[model samples]
Target: MGKQVVAESARRRRRPTKQGTVLTEAHIVETALRVLREHGSAGLTARRLGAALGADPSTLYRYFAGMDELTLAIGEELIGRALSGWLPGGDWREGLRELGLRIHGAYLAHPQAAVLTASRVSGRPREIEADEAILGVLRTAGFPDRAAVRIYHAFIDQTLAFAALDAASLALGRRARESDEERWESTYAKLPADSHPHIAATAGLLSARMKDSAYPAALDMLLHSAATQLAAARAADRGASGTSAR
Candidate 1:
């Protein structure tokens, strides 16, 4: 009896639900994202997804093994969007900068989904493609394997970290978001000069700047540091070659 039940479950997954609605993997992933955006991660369940899809909840298992697999699919979808129509240009730095921003923007565009999936490791095609692209950009620019891998790790992590952080803020309710934003002007901007001298002095700048995402500025600093490292590595290589020639 138990074996029959298991076999039946497997059969159910192989075919669409009795609803006669043909559900594609892409369709299910997209619907999952919509459910995530409208209702959030906690609200995403088999029953909720079924209603959204106009099919049985079990139909989702036909495409994905389970919810964890679905989450990875959602993450890959965001990465795919980041890579959509994007090609690396002549300037590696510029290419990397654009890639970083695209990734950041993609996550911010789907803040609710980002909050759930940004930290996930999908290891899926889209994610793998993105990794390969970043590494290729660094290696083609003359970075050694070690340096390229190191920079790639930092670059991807920093971009996703900021994406997740910014997305968390963006995912908040309107009033909550406003209240958090307002704290900069209402609290930090008004700090008394005597006790908090530095903040008071830069309060005006802080008020203006703190209202925006700092990812761009942070990305620039990272790129600049990478440029410096590349320059130093080249100089060292040249020095070693000159010594060998002597």
Candidate 2:
């Protein structure tokens, strides 16, 4: 006991003090989240987080095993934000639509973090809740359990994929966007009046809707398609089961 005490004392004397030992995983994660929002994935390093926290970078290791673990925590935080204030009451359609929009909005709000965590598969806290919420809505809306689960899968897959896709698109340089825009304006907008009547008619509407309004509209359309597909599959299942019994 005396030897252990001396060793502890010597270690304490040699060890440099961190900015604050009261620091915790939550604080680290919250700090990292802010860094991610402001500086993006490349900026979210243990060194950077520690520098922001006024501590040695190694101080982060005391809370997290490594960068991957910290990133998983960050991912959970993002998903938790998506699930916040998300009441699943009332119409199931409204519930699913709101859930999707909330998740998409949460990711879009933190595009860097969204891109970092979107490709990772971590079944953390908010991930489970989001799944339960979507599955419950699909099931209650008359989808068979299996079909409900499938639709839930598609719903989340679409949310993350589209969020990342848009973030990536926005991150591309203005030159790329300008060139793409010029191409569209020159080629599509210049379509002959009768050759591409639909494009000519709705090009203005498309241009207007592309200014962020298209996201929610696209999500609504996706949800509607999934719901319709689920309903048809459910009916076919019932019909098959009845025929077998007969």
Top candidate by TM-score: 1
Tens-place lDDT digits, model 2, residues 1-246 = 111212322333233335544566677788887897677788888788888877888766656667887888777888899898888878888888888888888877777777888877778877777777788888878887887777788788888888887766554545885676565566777788798899989777655555443567777887888768877887898999999999
Give per-model TM-scores: 0.92, 0.77
The clash tally of candidate 1 reads 0
For model 1, name the residue pairs that clash.
none
CA deviation > 4 Å runs, candidate 1: 1-21
Tens digits of per-residue lDDT for model 1, 30-114: 8888998899888889999999888878766756778888899999999999999899869999999999999999999889999
Worst 10 residues of 1 by lDDT: 1-10
